[model samples]
Every structure is written in C-alpha cells, then in structure tokens.
Target chain A: MPETIRDPADPRLDPYARMRERDLVGRSGRFVAEGEVTLRLLLGPRARFRAESVLLAPERWPGLAGALAACPAPPPVYLADKAVMSAVTGFPIHRGVLAVGLRGAEPEPGALVPPPPAPVLVLGLAGLTNHDNVGAAFRNAAAFGADAVLLDGPSCDPLYRKSIRVSAGAALIQPFARLGPGRDWLALAETLGLETLALSPGGAGGLDGPDLPTRALLILGTEGPGLEAGLLARARALRIAMAPGFDSLNVATAAGIALHALARAQGRLVPRGPNRGGG
Target chain B: MPETIRDPADPRLDPYARMRERDLVGRSGRFVAEGEVTLRLLLGPRARFRAESVLLAPERWPGLAGALAACPAPPPVYLADKAVMSAVTGFPIHRGVLAVGLRGAEPEPGALVPPPPAPVLVLGLAGLTNHDNVGAAFRNAAAFGADAVLLDGPSCDPLYRKSIRVSAGAALIQPFARLGPGRDWLALAETLGLETLALSPGGAGGLDGPDLPTRALLILGTEGPGLEAGLLARARALRIAMAPGFDSLNVATAAGIALHALARAQGRLVPRGPNRGGG
Candidate 1:
C-alpha cells in the first residue's frame, strides 16, 4: 500500500526534491532511478543496489504492484498526484515512477575482475565525462556479457539519473568500480594479468583480427582527445576501420562495437536462451 | 567580406531566427547545420547539400576562413557577437557556428543504392523517430563506409539540427533518401537486389555467422517495441548476442556494431591510410 502525500513540502519527500538541481551534485549516499524500466530493475530480483524508497503517481501503482510486492523487504511507497509530484521534483514526472537507490560501499576494482582462466571481459573507461556515454558503456558491457566495467578517475558517474535511464538500467545491475584519481589503470590491468587493448583512431590495426586475447581489458577514452599518450603506448592499440576522412563513432557506440566484436572473438558471449529477450 | 550584423531581427538573418521553435517544424526545404565540424563539412568539397549562408561569432572566423574561402562561389557570411547570435537563435550558440543548408531535391531510393556488382551496404531505418538515433545511424553508416541510408516513412527527418550535429556532419555528405509514407522498404530493398537483415531481440540467430551476404541492407527499428512484426517476418531476422536476460542495445549502438561487423565481413571497410583521422 502507498502512503498518499498531498503536500509537496513534506519532509518525507525530501529525497525527491529539486531533482534537476540535485542531479548536478551528490545525492549524499543515494541515487535517483527514474522511469518504469529502471525502477523495475532497482526493485527486481537481480538488482545489486537496494532501493531506499519509491515515489509514484497514483496511476502507476497498479502496474508496479507486483514488482513492489516481490521485493524481499519492500521499500516504502509514496503516492502523489501528478501536480504534487511535478512540484516536488521541479519537473514533470512524465514516467510517473521514481526510486531512491542506495549506493552502498564502493566495490574494490580487483574484486569486480574475475580470477584468471575464467574468460574475462572488462570494459575500462577513461576520462569519459559524458553521462550518456558512461551509461551507454555500461549497457553495452552488460549486453555483451562483460564481467564488469572499471572506470578511471576522470569518468562521469554511471549512477547519474540520465545515465541510468540511458543505460536501460544496466548501471544498476552491472558490476562496476572506479579507480582513484590519477591511479595507474594500466599497471592495475597488468597486475590483474589482463591484456590491455586501447581503442583509438590511430591504433595499430583493425578490431576484426583473431589475435584478441581471451582475457582482456578494452579501454575507451573520451571522444575527441581519446586516451592519453602514455596509456595508449603501454596497451595493445586497436582501431575500428572507417572510411577515409570521417571522424570516429560516438564513444559509446564505439564501445558497443568493440565489446560485441571482442566478446564474440573471445567466445565470451552467452547463447540466447529461448525465453530471453531477442536483442 | 563578411557582413557585420548588430540586430538579431534583421531580415537577412530570418533563416537563423527563433531556431529552437523552427526546429520542431520543417525549415522550408532548408536545414540548420551547427558546430564548426558540420559547418566545415557543409562548405567542404564533398558536401551533398549547398550552404545558403553562414552565421559565425567573430572569434570563429580566423579558423574557418580557409574552408569558407575554398567554397566555389562561397555563400554570404554574417558576422555577429555572441550576444546577437544567441538572440537570433533563441539559445546560446556555444559552438559559435551556424549555417543554413539547402536540402536540394530528394534522391530516389534506388539511386542512392549502388547498382548491382558494387559492394553495397545500405542502412534501412524503420520507425526511428529519435533524432539522435537517426543521426548516429548516419554517422555509423558513413564511418563503416555504408553506401547510403534509406529511411521508411515513419522515421524522423535526419536533417534536423540536433541530428546533423550528432551525425558529425554525415547527414550533409552521406547519400540518403526516404520512402513515401506507408511505402514498404523491404520491397524496395528486394528491388535493389540487396539481402535484407532485420535486427530484433527475437532474431533467428546471432549476428556473428559468416553467412551474411556481401551486399546487404541492415534494418534497424526503434529501441523498444523493435521492428514491426510484419516487417520482421518479411526479412531475415538477426540479433546481437547478449547476456541471457539483458535488454537489447540502444538502436544506434546496435547499428554501429552491425555495420562494423557486416562491413568487415563483406570487405567493404577501407583500410586506414597514412594520413586519415584515427577513429
């Protein structure tokens, strides 16, 4: 059952207030999940993060009742009319579903990487400041069965609301960790015994070759000035072949292509089960 | 010589006025091209569209002078300060570059598809209304050396400003044509003599198999609700291999992966020359 809240200023709804402004800053130890798909993922059985609470428009209650009921210890549900919900959030709650998710303690980078001989595929992001790219990277990583995503210090937070929405909620379920600022990600990959492949337009060769190692870290950087010179120098450099005189694909799109190709080449992709979604 | 404009309401600047509102509707057989990269592409030698005029912040002039000068019978250039430019466009022109491009006559779908015996890769988009996705598809198609992009009637216009910017100017240079509303794109593909492969979550098999034909049309639909059943039934259905329960990749990302793979499979991708951009 949902507690009906009439006032926008209710202290209980503080977490959902001024969302547009709050999105630019930290949510303390929490993050907001928006839309039905993402909220469902947060409350679903496979969720890695725990939901603190859920806010919903009255009309959304019926559709979400089952998922809410399925939670082991369901979070409190607050129901509001569209006007009050919009007033509280400082924007129209078009999807009519939102949840507050707890971030918990950060996972150690090494723990996210599986032990050797396990056919590992990890996506490493560097200097990716765009939330959309970070989210899309996580989505691609999960879609291709990459064990985890490791982000360098300069990358944007995948938990950002827009990213979570863009990722199709993969950021909530995918295993990920971030390296400390200025930390040597390459040295860490070396210590983990994972072959490092950096993607660049000027990479040594195309991505289709069979030489891709079974256990590898595919590093992606921001769109324009790609990975740093020192990082590209140490890792095996790979390029996606392109027509003459064109710029590269958007960074996230490139990550998707690289992850799919490398995952296929290494035989890491899982065969589609009959009951699963078709993509 | 560039004409200096002090007033935002000047009739000569009408094509650039109230850009945000005008973007929602058609531009009277014209399109807005934004950002330095796209402007350069519009004025470049290979551009498929012609520029009617260019508006620039004073600071952007020195850098773009060469490209502007190179245009045969170069379009008139309007110079304005950031303040006047922002007022005219109804938003801050952060990139400080804007141009009005003529759409020209719509090319026939058959004309855009290369005649038989040429290695053809045509991206067929269905019901993709998202400007960003449409733009990204064009960028991916251009990057992977797809001969052209064919859009069904339900798809959005690719010449929208945001689409043009997202396409990295591929929308200006890439050969593209749209089928009339309610037209069957698969029938057109059949007429073009290209094998049709539609991407879906429930696709018959994964995209990795070697059976993909050299000359093919890869069809992509919107992210959710994928391609319509009638269309999917008419074409060979294919899916990107994914982790068992994950949702499909974003349509644009899927297109990038598919285009890269099929282009490589068909030997249509051009090798990186010594001097081209590295992406």
Candidate 2:
C-alpha cells in the first residue's frame, strides 16, 4: 500500500514542493516529472532514470496500480488531496501526477559520441538555452534516431521540470550529456568524426544538396541570434529551403525538419506501426 | 511622441491589463501580442491585424522607434516602467513588449479553401485546442506557404495570447477560419476538391508516397486522442517515417514535417537562393 500524506509540508516532499524549475534541475541529479504522460515516459524501458518517489492525487492512485506493480522495485507513492497538492506545489497541478526521479550516472560527452568512419546521426546544441526547445529537440532526436544529444553551456538543463514535461519526457529517456563549462563544441564534434552540418536560414547548401555525409553532427544554435559566427564558420552551413520572406522556422521545428531529412538520407528513419488508421 | 503613463491603471490600457487570456481571445476580435519578436511580426507590412494599442516597458520604447513610426496609423504606444507594467499585468513580463491587435474581418472557411482543380497546400486543425500547438501550426502554415488553415469545433483560439506568441505572429497574418460547429470537417474538405490526408501514427502511406495531389488538405488532431474515429475513417491516412519505439512527434513538429513533405510534393515549396551563411 502507498503512503497517505495529509500534510502539504512534509519535509520528505521537498523534491516535489514549491521550488522553482531552475532550482530543481541538475540539483544532485534529481528532477521532477509532471503529468501522467511524462510519468509513464520516466518508467519507459530505455529510461536512464530511477524514480525516487511519487506525489500523486488520490484519484490517480487507483488508476496507476498496474503501472506501479510493473516497476522493477516500486517506489514510494504519496497520496495528497487536491487542496494539499495546490498548497504544496504553489499552484494547482491539474494533471495531479508528479514524480521525483534521480538520473543514473551519464557518460561524459566524449565517451558516448562515436569516433570517425562510423555511420551515425547526432544532434549538438550550442547555446540553445530554452528548456522547452531543449526538450523538444531531444524528443525530435529520439523520433529521428539520433545516437545522442550533446549540449554546451549556457544551455538550459533538459531535465528542468517544464522541459521534462515539454519533450513529453523525451529528455529523461533520450541519451544526453553536457559538453562542458568551456569547450570548442564544434572542434570536439569534428574530433569525434562528425561532419558538422550547421542548420541556418541562409546557407551554402540545401538540405537535399549533394552527398550529405553518412556520419553527420547537426548543430543548432539559439533561436534569435542563431549559431555563433565562429561556429557557423567552422561547420559546413546547410539550409532548409523554406518559403521566401520568412526568416526561419522555430528552432525546435527547424530541428525536426533538418533531423527528418538527415535521418532519412543516412538510412536511419523507417516507417513504423500497423501502417493504417481506420475506425 | 509615445504616451508616457505614470499610472498602470490608465483608462487607455485595459486591453493590456490582467484579463484572463480566455476572456481576451476573440472577444470582439482583439488579441494580445507578447514578446519583442511577435510584436514586430504584428507590425509586419503584410499583417492582417491592426495594432489597437501597445504597452511597452520603458527600456524597450527607444528601440521600437522605427517600427512605431512605420505603423500605417501608429496606435498609442503606452510607456510604463517595469514596476507599473508588473502591477498592471500582475506579473513580471521580462520581455516588456505586449500589444493588443484587432484582426480584420475574416473570410468564410469555404472561401479561403482551394477549389478542386487548383494547385495548393493547406492545413486543417480538427480539435487542436492547445494554444501553443495551434500557434505553432499557424507558424508552420506560413513557413510552408499553406493557402489557409481550418479549425473545427473544440479547438482553442489561435488568437489567444500564447498562440500568437508561439506562432511568432503567424496567427495575425496567416488566413484561418472556423469550420462548422456541427458539419463533418472531412466531408467539407472532400467537397472542396482536397484530397484529405489525415496525419496519424498508424497511417499507411509514407509521407513521401506517390501522387501527393496538388490540392491537398492535411488534417491534424490533438496530440493524445487523435482524429476522431469518424474523421479518420473519412480520410486517407498519412504518416511520417520515424525511428522505432516512439509513439509520435509533438503536434507542432508533426505539422512541420507533414507540411514540408506535402508542400514539397505539391511543388509548393521551392528551395530559396544564395544558400550562404557567413560570420
């Protein structure tokens, strides 16, 4: 049976308390997952996270019985009424599902990255600091079969609570790591044998242009300022041929398009499922 | 000269005040624009919205001089310091750029949709109620040059503040209209000579599949409970080839990918020129 906590101020609930997302992220490698969708993702087979505990609205406790029973070793599940939940979280959590999970030790960026002469697709984020964008990129990376994602500062933490929710919990499952406090992200990618393709609005080659290398690292920059000039200079600039007059697609959307194209070209993407939608 | 208001409660500023986003959206056609990027888009030359009034943080007032001067009939630009801005909005709006714009009268859904014989591309929102998703759909519509967007009942307002912001102001300029509250959305598209291709995870045809008609209406549903069974039954199903294990892409990203493929197949997308990225 799960624990029932009538008090909103239980000291054990600090991880799911009214702390800001920024403060909660990357703090001793613990993170919060919001909503049932993300909670399910956290327990996905490939997730590199361990649920420390769950704070669930009472109504949800029954519905989650099957999921709980399936956990390798069920974590503690705390039940709270809506009023207590509101008081504890500083706001109403409409979905009423949140879990605090600890990330397993992730390898250094250098280790997970593939070395030269290998056919691979990897996504590298440079100064892409919005948590939602980072989360969305991670989701897209997974969708398109990228090997992993590497981020360089000052990028927002993908494990930030909102990011975890936004990427639909892809940030938790997708293999990702920090490149560092200071590193020539592009040079490092090249050393890993990735031919960097910097996606830009104005580029020298269309996404469909000649001979996209079998081994590629697609680098994206922040939305507004875009990739740094030096990074743009180092990478072979590639553009998605968009309708004229529009400057660019949203950074995350751009990533989806670019990743889809590159993934297909490198023979990574494949059509999946029953392959039919019918009543 | 822009109006300088010492009072946040100035009578002229109600449009920019703390009204609920739900109440403000489509209330006599007025909509809020948030952030610097969207405010600029609202003032773009081809915009179909009239700036009713603008509330600017004191710091941003100077940088916007050129944009303000260029308005066809510049709306009152209300200048308020951060404190006043916060008190009025009941939150610290870090960007300090918010404008209320009134949309022009819209054409009927029937009028904007392409006829059977025309070469075209369009997006349809069946029940997409999330403001961000709706907004992103509009932004993608604009990016790929879709003829228009159609929203059926139960969908959120595209003019909602967050939608407009997420759309990068695409909602202000992209042509969109509500479909029948009761009529079959799919039947209406078929009648319009559009080959209705519903984007679904279980879709049979690869997005790159042959004979993607020139006159096509790609319909999308909410992320979770996708297109209603009846609607899915009435349309041909289409899918994006993605890596295995993932259930689906975010609605917005899915829109970008689907739209890109459909648009390209219809010869609606042309890879633009110069193809150059420089430091």
Using all chains and alpha carbons, the TM-scores for the candidates as numbered come to: 0.97, 0.91
Cα lDDT, model 1, residue A222: 85
Best-fitting candidate, measured by DockQ?
A: 1
Instruction: Report the Cα lDDT for candidate 1.
Output: 0.86
Worst 10 residues of 2 chain B by lDDT: B19-28
* Residue B189 local lDDT, model 2: 73
**Deviation in angstroms for B217 in model 1?**
1.7
Q: Tens-digit lDDT track for model 2 on B76-122?
A: 88888878888887778788888888867867887887666778787
Query: Which segments of model 2 are wrong by more than 4 Å?
Result: A6-14, A21-26, A80-90, A114-118, A275-279, B1-3, B7-10, B21-26, B55-62, B76-90, B93-96, B114-116, B273-279
User: Worst ten-residue run, lDDT, model 2 chain A?
Assistant: A19-28
Interface RMSD of 1: 2.9
> Candidate 2, fnat value?
0.51
